[model samples]
Target: MANKVYNFSAGPSVLPEQALKEASAACIDFENSGISILSMSHRSKPIENMFAQTEQYLRELMGIPEDYDIVFLGGGCSLLFCMLPMNFLDQNATADYALTGVWANKAYKEAKQFGNALAACDTKSETYSRIDKNLKLSDNATYLHVTANNTIYGTEWHNFPKPKSGFLMADVSSDFLARKINVSDFGVVYGGAQKNISCAGVTVTIIKKGLLGKVNRTIPTMLNFQTHIDAANMFNTPPVFAVYVMNRTLKWLKDFGGVDAIEKVNRSKAALLYSALDNSKVFVGTAAKEDRSIMNVPFVFNKDVVAADKADDLAKEFLEFAKARGLQQLKGHRSVGGFRASIYNAMPVEGVQALVDCLGDFEKKVLG
Candidate 1:
C-alpha cells in the first residue's frame, strides 16, 4: 500500500481512512452477501436496506425534522440550481440570490434563465472577499438562494442572513454533512456528496415534505423532486456503490460521535492553520478575517514584500514543495490564484498541523 498522503482537494476530497478500508472490504464482497454492492440489483432487498439505512443515519446525524424528505438524487448540487426553481418558481415568481462567489453566481445565472432572479446582495465588486450584510432581499421572492461556503474564495457565512420573504435555500456542497446545523432553519438544503459525504456520483437533497409539486413548470419525472421522494430515492438505478460508501461513511461519523464531535475538530484544525498564517510575515490569508472559511483556507504572500508578478510562480513553487512533503492538492482553483488547503471532515487535525508547520518553514526560508 502507498503511504497515505494528506489530501486537501476541494471536491472528491479526502475520506476517513477507516471508511475507505471498510469500503474496500465491502467492494470485494459486501457483507458476504455473495455479490459486490455494485453488482447487486438496485431493487434487491440488500441494496434497499442499504438505501434506507443510509437515509436514516444521515437524518439522525443531521437532526433532520420529521417533516423533511431526504432524497438521494442524480446530478450534483448544480442540478438543484435548476430543480429548485423549476419546482417552486412560476409566472411572476422570483427568487432572491446572494451572489457571494463563483458557485452562487452560476446558480443565479441558471435560475435566471428559467425565471426571474433578483440579486439581493452581490460581492462581485469586492472580488468575493467577504459577505455583504446589507442585503436587499426581494419582498415577493419565492425563495432566497445562497451558497453557505465559497469554496474557491475561502469565505463562508458563519451565520446565514435572515430573509424578509420566502423560505431559505442553501447549496452547501462543501460544508454539508460536516458539522451540526439547525435543519429546521432551511426550506431546502442540497449538496453533492463528493466532499464530506462520499464520492461524486450522488447528490443529496433534503426538502420540506409538503413544499414540492406547486410549480407550473412541467419538469421531467427524473428532474422532479416529488418523483424522487415518492419512489424513496429508488426511482431509477441509483449510484449503488456510491450510496453504499456513503452509508459506511455515515456510520463512521456516528461512531465518531456525530457532527458535533467532528465540528470541534474542524474548528481546531482551521484555527491552527489560520494562526500560522497570521504569525507568518511572508504569508497572509486571502479572505477577510471574520469571513474566513473553516473548510478551505486560501493564503498568499504579502505583496508589499513580494511582487504581484511573482505570486503565481511562487504559488506553483509552494504547491510542488508541499506535495513533495506529502501534502497533496494544495494548489488553489485556477480562477482564484493562491494556495487553498481544504480541511474537510475526514482530514485529521494532525494533517492541519503538518501543513501549518510547512507554512512556517517555507516562510522562514523565503523571507527570513
Candidate 2:
C-alpha cells in the first residue's frame, strides 16, 4: 500500500501538490499582503492580478482565441445552465441540446424554461454509453449545446459537433483543463473550476464576443455574460480564494508543460486503467468502448463472475479494501451501482498503477 492517499473524487477533486502548498500559505499571508486570500477584497490589486494571470494561463494552455472573453462566475455550471438560455435563446429562435448525461439533461431542462430548446440527439434511453455523432441539429437554431464529458456514465465526446448556421456551446465541467481544445470550435466553453482546475466556488467561462447581443429578452445584470466581461469578472464580489487557488493551479499546470503535455499523461493514465479493465476477469467497464471517458472510469464486478444479487456486497468489500490501501472516493455515483476511478489531471501514473494493482489483487481474491 502506498503511503500517500490517492483521491478519485469527481469534483472538489485532486489538485497539484504545489498548488495546494502555495494555497495553504496564501491562506495566512497572500502575496505578502498580510491578509488571507479569503480576507482580500475582490477589487484589490492582488486579486485582480491573480484573476488576470489565471485567465492568461488558461488562454495559453487551451489556445483560446483573442476573439473570446474569459470570466469567472460565483455559481458553477448549474448557474450557467440558466444563463446560457437567458443570454442566447430568444423567444422566437430555438436552441438544440445534446442529451449526453445527467448534467446534460439538467442543462437541457433548464433551457426549456427560457425558450424552445430541443434535443438534437438523446441517448438517455441507451444509458448514455456513447456519444451520438449523428446529431439532428436544426440549421436555424440559435445554438447547439453539448456536455463535453459525461461524468456519471464515463463517456466523452472525442469529436465535437458543428452547428450548420448557429454557434456551438459546451458545458465542460468534468473535463475542463484536462486536455487541449480549439477555442474557435464553440461560441461558449464554460465549466466549474473544481474538477480539473481548482477548488469549488468558481466557474470559468470563455465566451465568443460575437455570441452576445443576439437575444432580445432582458437578462439580469449578473446573468448577462456581457456584464462580467465588462467588469473583468469582478462585477460584484468574486470568489477570491478559489480564484487565487485557480491561479496557482494554472501556474502549476504551465510548469508541468501545459495542456498538451498533461493531456498525454492523462491519456496514458486512462489507457492503463482501461487496459486493466478490458483484460480483467472480475471487472467490466460500463461505458461503451468508443466513448469511454479518459477522466472518469466506471466499472463493476463482472456479473458473469459474481451474481447480480451479490454485486453490491462485492462492491462494498472492494471499496473498503481499496480504501485500506490509501485509495479514497473510488465509490461510484449512487445512481451508478459500481466503482468509478476519476483520474483527473493531478492523478499521476503511479496512482493509476496502484489502482490497477489493487483491482488485480481483488480480482484474484474474488476468484480464489
Candidate 3:
C-alpha cells in the first residue's frame, strides 16, 4: 500500500496492478519487436500471435468448449444489444428477456426494436432490488436473454433460470469471467471486457457453433458475429491495445489459480462487506440477501440518521472520507440512490477489510 486509493468503478474499473505494470513496460516496444501493439498491423504475425494467444488464454481460463466460437469484437456489450437480435431474431420469432436492472432493460429495449421481444419478468416496480425467480418463459421464444448481474442495483442471479425455448443468451457484462461458470449452459455469452477482464474498448462473445445462421434477417457484416468468427476476430482493426491488456490480465488470472481462486477471494470480500452492513446499526444493504451481487454491493445509511433527500449528501461525504482513507469509487450509480462498492476480481481481501473498518470508524465518529 503506497498510499494509493482503491478503485471500484462499475466498468472501466480496477485491473490487476501486475498487469498494469506489465502493460506499461510493453507499451513502447513489445518484447523488443520494435513496435507497440497499437502501431502493429493487424495482419502481421506478431499481432496475429498476440490475438491467437489471447483468445486461447481466454478460452482456457473460462473453460470454453471447442464448439464455441470465441470472438473479440469491437464496440462494448451495448453493441451486442443490437447484434444479438439482428443475428438471432427471425421475423416471426420472439426473444424472451428477464429485466432485472438498467442494463437488462436496455438490452430488452434494443431487442424489441429489431424483432419481437417479451419480458419474462421485470422487477422495475420494486426498483430492481431483487431477482424474479418465477419468470414465465415463452414457448416460441428464439432465445432467452438475461443479465447475470445488475451493477447498478447490486442484484445478481446466483442460479440462472432454465429457458423453455430454443437457446439461452446472457449479458454477463459485470460478472462474466469473474467466477466459475458452466460454459455449456448458454448458447451465447457476451460481455464488455472493462468490468473484470480489462479496460474499455473490447467485448467478448462466445457463441455455440450450431446456434447461429438461423435468422433470415440480413445483418451488417460488422455487426454479424459470424463475420468476426470467420476472420478470427480480425475482420477490422480490432482494439489492439485493449486486447493486449486483456491478454495480460488473463495471464495474471491463470497465475493466480484462475476463476476458482479469484471467486473464493470475491466471496470473502463480499461476505466481509455484507457482514459489516448486517452488523452495523448505521447501514443496511439494499438488495435481497439471496439475490445480492458479489461484485457490486449497495447499502444505505440508516434512515434515522440520514434522510432520503440527504442521502446523496451523505454519500458524497462518505466518498470524500473514504478517498482520504485510500478507498475510491464507492459512490453508487445515479439510477439507484445509494452507495455501492464494486468488489471485482481485482479487489483484494485487504481492500474489503479496510472498507469494513472504515465503515465502523465512520459510524463511531458520526452516529455514536
Candidate 4:
C-alpha cells in the first residue's frame, strides 16, 4: 500500500488486498485451468462453481433465507432502474418510493415511465439531509422502493424501512456488505457489485422466490428477474471475472470475521471520522446526525467561518492539503460538493485514522 493513497472513491471503490491478489492470479491462470476467467466458458463447471460459490458465500454472510435466490445479472443498478419496474410495477397500480437521495429519485422517475410511481415521501428539498421513517405509503401499492444507502450525499438508512404495505425492494449498492442485515425483512434486495462487493461488471439481485412472477405483463426475457433465476444466473453469459472477484471479496469478508465483525469496524471508522468532523472548527458534517452513513462521510470545511463565502476556495485548499498528505479521492460529488470520504468495508481503521488526522491538521493550520 506504499504508492496507493487511502482510496475513498465511492464506487468501483477499494477492495481487500487478499481479494485483489487472488483475483490477479485468477486472471492469469485460474486454479490451474489453462484459461483465465476472462476466457472461461459460462457453461463450464468452473464458471458454474464460481457463481455457486459466490452466491453461497453471500447467502451465508447475509443469512438469506431459503425463499430468496441470489442472481448475478449483467447491467448495473442503472439498468435495474427500468428493468425493476418493467417486471414489478403493474400498469394499474402504484409503485411507492421514498426519495431520500439522488439515486432513489432516479428510481422513482424511472418507475413513473412504467406506471403510477408515487413519492411516499421525499427529502430532496432539504438536500436529503435525513430519512423520513414515517413514510406515507399505501398498502395496496405494487411495492415500496428505496435506496438503502445514498453515496453522493452520504446519508444512509441504518435501519431499512419495513413497509407494512406491499413488497419492499431496496438498492443497497454502497452499503451491501458493510453491516449485518435481516434478509427476511425484504421481498427483494439488490445492489451493484462495485462498491463493497467487487469491480464494476455485475449486479447482485436477491429476490424472494415467491414474490416474482406476480407482475401482470409480458416481461421481456432479459428484463425479467425470473429469467436470470431460471437460468441460474447464466442467461446471456454472466460477467465471469466480476463474479469471480466478488466471490473472492466475499471470502475475504468471511475470513475477516463476517458481517458482524465488519459492522463493528465500520461503526468505529464512522465514529472516528464523525468525531473528527464534530471537533473540527473548519469542517461541518452534512448528513443528519441519526441518519448519517457508515459507508460515505461527506463533510464541508469552514461553512460558518468568515471565509465561508470562499467555501469553495477553502475546500479546494484543504483537498489539496489532504491529497499531499496521501489522502486521495477526497473531493465530494458534483451535486453536493465539499468532500466525501467513502469508508467501505475494505477501508481499514488505520486509513480512517489517517483521514481523521488530516482533518485535524488541516483545521488547525487553515482555521488558526
Candidate 5:
C-alpha cells in the first residue's frame, strides 16, 4: 500500500490538507470566539468579516470586476440551472445553451421551463468527446450559456466562444479556480463549491448587476439573483461553515501563488498522466487531445488489450487494484463506464506519478 492515500473524486473531492487542518481547528473554536464555526451565527461580526474576506479573495484570485457581485448561496449548482433562466431569460429573447455534456443538457432543459430556450450547439451526438467552438444562435438571444468544463466526459473548452450578440454565462463547476480566467468575458459565472474550491453546501455566483431585472416575468424572492446580491449574500441564514472553509481554502490557494502558479502545476500534473496514457499500450484517452480537461482525465482500457465484451470486468479489476494501492476514486462517471482520474488543484504531483506507476503495473498484470 502507498504511504498515503490520494483522493480523486470528481466532486466533494480532494482539498488542501492545510485548509482541512485549519477548518478542523475552527470547527472546535472559531477565531477564538469560543464557538465552533458550524455553530457561529450567520449574523455575527466574525461571519460577516469572513464573507467580506471570502469575496475579496475570490475577486483578487479571479480578477472579478467591481461591477460584478459575488454571492454565496445554499442550493447546489443544479438549482442555478432554474434560477438563471428565471432571473435572466427574457420574454422576447431566447436562452441559448451549448450542450457540451450532461450538466449543460440539464441546464438547457431547465431553461425551457422559463421561456424560449435553444440548444445552440450540442455535442452529445459525438459522445461529448469535444467542445464546439462555434454556436448557433439567433440575434434575439438573451444569453449564451456554456459549461466551461465537462467532468463526466473529460472535455473542457480550451478556447471560449464569443457570442456576436448576447452575453456569455458559464457553469464553471468543475474547473473553478483551476486556472486563470478573464472574469469580464462572461456575464455571469457560477459553480458549486465542492469541486475545486472547497466543500459542498455552498454555491458561488458572480454576476453582473446590470444583467438582473431584465427578464419580463417576475422571479420568486429566493430564485432572484438580485435578492442575494442586494442582501450581500445574507438574504437568509448563510451556509456559515462551508463559506468559512472556502475562505481558508482560498487563503491556501493565494499563499500557494494563486491561480496562475497553480495553473502551471495543474497542467504539469495533467501532462504526466496524459503522457502516460499517450504511451500506454493498454489505455486510451476518451476525450479529444485538443479539448481534454486538465482536471479530469478519463481513459479506458484499450479494446486491443481487453476485448469489448470484457472491458467492464477489466475496469472493475483495475479500480480495485488502484484502490488497494491507496489511489482512491479512480472510477469514471457511471455514464461513461471507464476510469476518470480527477486531479484537482489540491492533488500533488506525487499522487499522479503513483497512479502512473499503478497503470504500468496493472497493464503488466493484465497482459500476463
Candidate 6:
C-alpha cells in the first residue's frame, strides 16, 4: 500500500499488526463474554486469567526464575528511578550509577534525594557515545544502576555489567525483549512498555524477591515495591486497556517464537540498515562502531565529510525524499540533530529495507 510508510519512531515505536487486530477484537468483546476488556472489573476472573497468563508468557520467554516477581505497574521507568532508591537504598550507604545517557543521569540525580548517590562512571565527556564497563563504586554502595540502552545517543551495552557486591539494577526502557538476556544478571530489571512492549500506560518491573524491604527510609505505600507485589499490580485500578493490548502483543511474541526469534529478525534488520549506512558517502553513524545500537541506528548526513554545501541541505532533502516514498520518522532527537531509525522487535525487515533503499536512492541522487 502507498500509505504503508516505514515507521522509524524511537518509541511507542511499532507494534505487530496482528496484536493490534486482536486487541481491536477484544475491545468490542473479549473471550466472547460480551464484556469489553476496557469495561471489565479489575478483579474479574477473565481479566485475572489474561493478566496471569501474560506474566507467565513473559517468564517463559525470558527464562525469569521463580524467585523474581514480575509486576506491571504505572508511572513508567521515571517513577521507578525514585521508588528504587526509596525501597532499597539505606541511609548509611550510597547507590552507584553508570551515567551513560540522559535517563541514567536523571535516575542517578533522582536517587540523591533518598540517600548518598554516586556516579560510578559517566560517558558525558565522550558525548555518551559508548558504555564504560569498568566502574568505581563506594565500598558501602547499596546498589549499582545502569541503563541497558541509550535511545538518544544510539549506543547500547552489548555486555551487561554485574555489580561486585550489591544488587544490580537496569533501566531497560528502550530494548526490552529485543534480545535475549539472563534475568538473573540483575536484582531488578524494569522499563516503560511504550518502546517495544506496548502502548505507554504500563511499566513492567522484574525484581528479585530478596531485594525488597531493605531500605531504612519509611517509604510511601504507593512508592513501595512490596505494595505492588502484594496486590499483584492491583494496589490501584490498573491500566486495563494498555495491559490488554500488551497481553495481546505478548501472545504475538510467543506465536512468533518469543524473544530468540524476534532477536534474530531484529539483528538482520539492523544489519541491513547499518550496512547501508556504513557504505553511504553522505550518511555517517554517530555512535562508536562497537557500541552502536542494533535497535536504534542514529546517523547524520555529513556534508563536510562527503560534499561541500549548506550544512543540513542534504539531510533535509533526504528526509523529504524518504517521507514522500513511504519511509517516515527518520529524524533524530531534537538535542541531537540527525536521523535515527529504530528497528524494534515488531518493525519488519521490509520496513528497514525500505529505509535502506531510500538511503541508497538518496545517495545516488545527491552525489551523482
Question: In candidate 5, where is summed lDDT lowest over 10 consecutive residues?
Answer: 87-96
lDDT tens readout by residue for model 4, 191-284: 8989999999999888887777777889888888888888898878888999988999999999999999999999999998999889888788
Q: How many residue pairs clash in all the candidates, one count each?
A: 0, 0, 0, 1, 0, 0
Cα deviation at 95, candidate 5, in Å, is: 1.7
Please give each candidate's TM-score.
Answer: 0.97, 0.98, 0.97, 0.97, 0.98, 0.96
Give the Cα lDDT of each candidate.
Answer: 0.87, 0.90, 0.88, 0.87, 0.91, 0.86
lDDT of 3 by residue, 104-140 (tens): 9999999998788999999999889999989889988
Over 4 Å off, model 3 = none
- Return the clash pairs for model 3, or none: none
Question: What tens-digit string does per-residue lDDT give for candidate 2 at 198-265?
Answer: 89999988889878988888888888989999998888998888888888888998999988899999
**120-192: candidate 5 lDDT, tens digit per residue:** 8888888899988778876878788999999899999898888767789999999999998899999999999
- Score candidate 4 by lDDT: 0.87
Q: What is the C-alpha RMSD of each candidate to the true structure, in Å?
A: 1.4, 1.1, 1.3, 1.4, 1.1, 1.5
Query: How close to the true structure is residue 1 of candidate 2, measured as C-alpha lDDT?
Result: 57
Tell me the lDDT of model 2 at 242: 87
Position 135, candidate 3: lDDT: 89
Model 5 spans > 4 angstroms off: none
Model 2: residues >4 Å from true position, as ranges?
none
Q: Give the per-residue Cα lDDT of candidate 3 at 161.
A: 86
TM-score of 2: 0.98
